[model samples]
Target: MTTTPSLSRTDWTLILSLALLTFVLGTSEFVIVGILPDIADGLSISIATAGTLVSAFAITFAIGTPLTMSFTSHLPKRKLMLTLTAAFIVFNLFSSLAPTYGILLVLRMMTAVVTGVLISLAMLVASESVPTGKRGIAVSFIFGGFTMANVFGVPLGTFIGQRTGWETTFLLTTTLGVIAFFAVYRVVPSQLTSVKTSIADQLRLLTNPRILIAFFIPAFGFGATYVVYTYLVPILKGVLGVPVAWISPILFAYGFISIFSNMAAGKIASHNPIGRLRFVFLIQALVLAALYVTTSNVTLGLINIALMSFMAILLTTSTQIYLIDLAEKFNPDAKGLASSLMPVASNVGIGMGSALGGLVYANAPVMTLALVAGAVALVTALLTAVSHQLDQR
Candidate 1:
């Protein structure tokens, strides 16, 4: 028999603080999309060149996460979290002050490296802070912070960037980072021990087929969404005929719906991780297919976008929980590396999707992105089914 640990108020406070930390980092990462045009105009670069900032961040994050985690594996969780938070704040501040696009790009890469490690560490903290049974909920709460970033942070940052400048968005992120740093300092318990594992042990987990497959589940799953999502503004404005002014609000609505979807995912994931992922991925694939069909009409297009956003994030918590659980069961000594790989795989998916979207945008109509992404989502569902069967066996 298994028992769920009871969480106290202090645990909830710590969880909320970690969530806020993710919200701050997520907003800094994602706000670039909303302000891409401003960044291009401000730096006298083409929008396409400015867009590389996004890719730079994602690529760096993908490469940097495990590397950073390996180096910091010996440090206490709270101390490492605080250190990363400080680095994040300082780098984002430098980003806002970057005079040239080149300098800004470098600063963003620095921030991404730290942010990736920070998020991975945050997950470890959250999972350790909660009862074993509630790990899913804690992970979801942290991810919910990112959802909140999309909901309030990105739109508001977009509005501010449009009016003042894109640099202002970075400055704002820095401020939020400061607040998050203090919150973590005050609330998060400092006695949490680190997961100590040698480099060889960590590397050995990579050789495991199950870990490798589990890592790619998110890579393809997120790739499916980001392929269309990278060009969502153009899709809404040029293809769907939505006015420029309404794009933010539409995104705001999409983000708003995502919050509930994220919470619902948390609940469903706790009960049935594999089944929940299958359902979410299947719905995501179908919705992307519907998005391809609906792009010609504004109402249907908006509805499909909302549905896609809703279903897209449903896999996040489950993915985190499943991977971590897998790590604990199969690769206990290297659970840190396993946890870190979740975000790394996610960024890989983001990078792939964005790169593919760019290719489609150059050669084909934007609506075609949906078809390609939908196919990817279907592949993700199949992978989930295979993973489920393997677990059952």
Candidate 2:
């Protein structure tokens, strides 16, 4: 595709609106982690049980998203987006009022059912609304919202939860969702058409070897980061000898760096995505490996981690564009399902990597987890190379 000079104002509006919606969605999904203890205390549940909200949301998001998206593929694009956004707000509203831990857990899971689909819809809308060359930037900005949530929304929500109450965190999310809904409605075209397809049509995407391999790219790429990220606090405190007082600032800085990483991913996806992804993962693998040596020194450890954070989402935008582009080639009608794959694969990677990391952490030195994650990142590079080769054939 020929490169466009710049996105038009209208395109920017639509994309930004979608980004705002994703920021809200991202905040809702992740803010629970910071307030897990508060939630446990509020509901008289163990902290371990409160932690299940995070895992449950991720599992449901991975399993439920494609099914929900596939079944709703025929709906008008704008309506589907609005409906999902409204549903998200309603779920969060209820979540804010749940009287019991079980009720809150169920609401969080229900919220997950719509969360991934809404994010996928945002990416789909952004990609289709822009020129081909600019689609990458559009999608990246949509993903950028999540990073922004990490940078701004999650931290702010955490503060609110701590100072006020945990329930207030969901209420904050609901307020943001309401704003996002209006932004989406005002900017998104009401007549946006969708490619009509049956559930079988969407499921048939799994039969394509190219796509099957493509799905694993995000899984491995993201898994590489999550393995270590899942235990980041412990690594910082135990391995790097970082004091408790500095942890928040360090995490805030990490999230701040991730926003730039998200922007870099846009440019990578703008052309030759698979080829670029091959090297992105390779560099990421090298960075993760470096963490083994760096963890022994506080300054080096922080810098290496910042570098790792920069590499974290480098694959996300490109992988997303890759999946949607492949679907367009082999099965145009299944593009909605394709849109859902990046998030689904990402959650799968996170779950798998965290589980693997937990096992390793229990049995080996914490620094060893970085080497294991690096190996997974190398696998991501290998998969990308294979994907690029398949493209040639």
Give all TM-scores, in the order shown: 0.93, 0.98
Question: Superposing all C-alpha atoms, what RMSD in Å does each candidate have to the true structure?
Answer: 2.1, 1.2
Tell me how candidate 1 scores on lDDT.
0.87
Per-residue lDDT for 1-393 in model 1, tens only? 977777779889988998999999999999998899999998999999998998899889988888778767888887888888999899988988889999999999999999999888888888877887787888888999999998888888888989999889988999999999999899878787676778887778888889888888999998999999989998998999998889867877878998988888778777879866887788889999888789888988988898888887788888887887888888887777777888888888988888888998899977899999999999999999889889989
Q: Using TM-score, give the best candidate's number.
A: 2
Per model, how many backbone clashes are there?
0, 0
Best by the lDDT measure: 2
Q: Which residue pairs does candidate 1 place in steric collision?
A: none
